[model samples]
Target: MPGLNVLAGDLLNVMRFYTRLPLPVFRFEREAHALPDFRRAAWAIPVTGAVVGACGALAGGLAYLAGLSPLIAAALALAMQVAITGAFHEDGLADSCDGLFGGASRERRLEIMKDSRIGTFGGAGLFFALLLRVLALAELFRLMGPAALVLLPGIAALSRAVALMPVLLLPPAGSQGLAASVPLPGLPAWLLATGIGAIIHAVACLWLDLPLGGLVSGGLALMLMPALAALARRKIGGHNGDILGGCQQVAEIALLLALSSAANWRGPL
Candidate 1:
């Protein structure tokens, strides 16, 4: 087995690719390893999400410029994320919604979440989620122009960063949910790093002249997880991997909607 230092280094190497940081790696080994911990990959989830979100925004913006319907572009961009991540969180979100609403017992809910097959509730939940995202992106693209294209990935990263709050504050409820499998991050370390990330995101927004869009709107978007975490803890007993992913999806959607609205009402800063 690789030493702890080597393992940590390897993990960081894999993670660097997901974040905005620039790091180089050897060519031969780049594609050799399968992502070992999909649960641990939560840290990287937002980074990958940001990439896909940016692509979607770009597709939307370009299509709008080319006279295509804004909705198509937004939908395609959303499709891109679904394609890239295989709708990983969306699946989690759907399963979670189904489990939350349809399952009668804790065990039954977990079982329903574990089933790979999509249920009626899950399907409907997914449709609404995607529809909301598509419509939201279309409106933003139509109104915000190129800035909308550039900010999607950043917004995604920020929202995922927000999802970190639960991992920092709450314990996993399930014995086998993905969050339970992921080693709990040291609260101080993760929160400190997250704070820095949040500051940087805010600074970027301000530097980009997003005005009230950054502080007020951005802050509101980021607030979803803590609120949801409080609700989940009260209702479900604790956080789980599905809950974490669900947090990410919800945060992203909320941030996008809030920012888009802010950008519309408040003129360029």
Candidate 2:
């Protein structure tokens, strides 16, 4: 019972660290302001992420069912998700793009990534990423109806865990932010996170009678993302919060597109 209680606290800690959601804390505490112990919270990443994703799914599904255009519903869903997370991952993608493309040297790249202002590459990246997500989701909802929205929680959860796995191998880019400060999880923790993500996605797919597009997307991300890791290593020496965020964003987009394509192949979603 004590172990379960501790686990629950750890999960809450992860949620507090990763999101901007308003959650209850112990009465005596001002708030959960301390950084989470990622080492212990690693397994809960997918669980916390899925909760956020489900909020978006519920919002979009309700809007579509309420007779709004699927595109508008999709946009609303995306907006809700952005609001919930405060666009945490999207900001990372922008920084990554700006740093990787706009800078001529490793130092310059890191500097660009650390800057608060978005550059031309960053702006372009943000536009395309958001556009692609909205369009893919709209098409998905059109084809699959509400079932499409149901897949989001699983995708959201899986993307987060899978995208950060590379960090287990790579070192930090600098000695400053989350990438540098958080304790590394062991192989067991990563495996636990991955296994839980897969199970969550599998249950959702089975419930919807949909193909295992989550696995396919996850596999593809694992295959393709070594390049990103290598690029980061060569460009800025190691991993950072922004780079990890970029990974999560890319993985999430790919999962959405893969599921959409798969549903289309299934005929009438």
Candidate 3:
């Protein structure tokens, strides 16, 4: 294990890569401004995810307490998240969609994804995904009020951590792009991340006072990734940063909907 300072540097590196926040660059840290060594930083990704979600929830929680409608509050929360992340995963989702659906051939699909231009499929997928996320957050807020805040951070943490699964499961799509350039996180990195995710999950369960419900919702979210991994494998023969982002989006959506369902369950009539 690294010393406290090394871990702190790793956390800072992950946060720098994951968001647009202007963090203080440490002169002593070798990779402060460069792409993170994700293997070392993988454990910190969930921590940063939790921080991002908590910041958003704080904004939304305040809005709800200020008497805003749940819908408005949910929107505000998501907006904060976007502002923080610069829609990093969202951009990846759009590109992945354009590449996955617009191009018939694998090479063409990868080319389209690299074009940096949005197409019909990309636009619609981004729109609906954002809509679904906002609506799901609203539903959770409507049902659980401020208590809903507990789920978002932990689930966000878990989703980001699990998003790394595709990295472990597939090869880089090509010799270019991030999947190929950066060293992919190995099993040990992923295990560290998963351990952090489990802690976050347990804390969320305790806070929400719903151990079974957390497991149910979080479990469904976990189940969603394998299908996504398979799709990526078929479409492009491997994974990339964009596919990993798509995985995060899918996991977040799955967890939100599952948690919403748990909140809405009213028992058999």
RMSD of each: 4.7, 1.9, 2.1
Please rank every candidate by TM-score, starting with the best.
Answer: 3, 2, 1
lDDT tens digits, residue span 1-269, model 1: 44555545445443543333344554544443433343343344444545656666676667767877777877777776666556767877887787777777776777777788888998998888888888877777677655566667766667666766777667777787556754555655455435544554565466556767767656786677788788667656678877777877787777667777776786543
TM-score between candidate 3 and the true structure: 0.95
Q: Give per-residue lDDT, candidate 3, residue 61.
A: 93
Clashes of 3: 0
In terms of lDDT, the best-performing candidate is 3
TM-score of each: 0.79, 0.94, 0.95
Candidate 1 clashing pairs? 56-77
lDDT agreement with native, every candidate: 0.65, 0.83, 0.85
Off by more than 4 A, model 3: 266-269
lDDT per residue as tens, model 2, 68-140: 9999999999898888899999999999999989999988999999999999999999999999999999988
lDDT of 2: 0.83
lDDT of 1 at 215: 72
- Give model 1's TM-score versus the native structure: 0.79
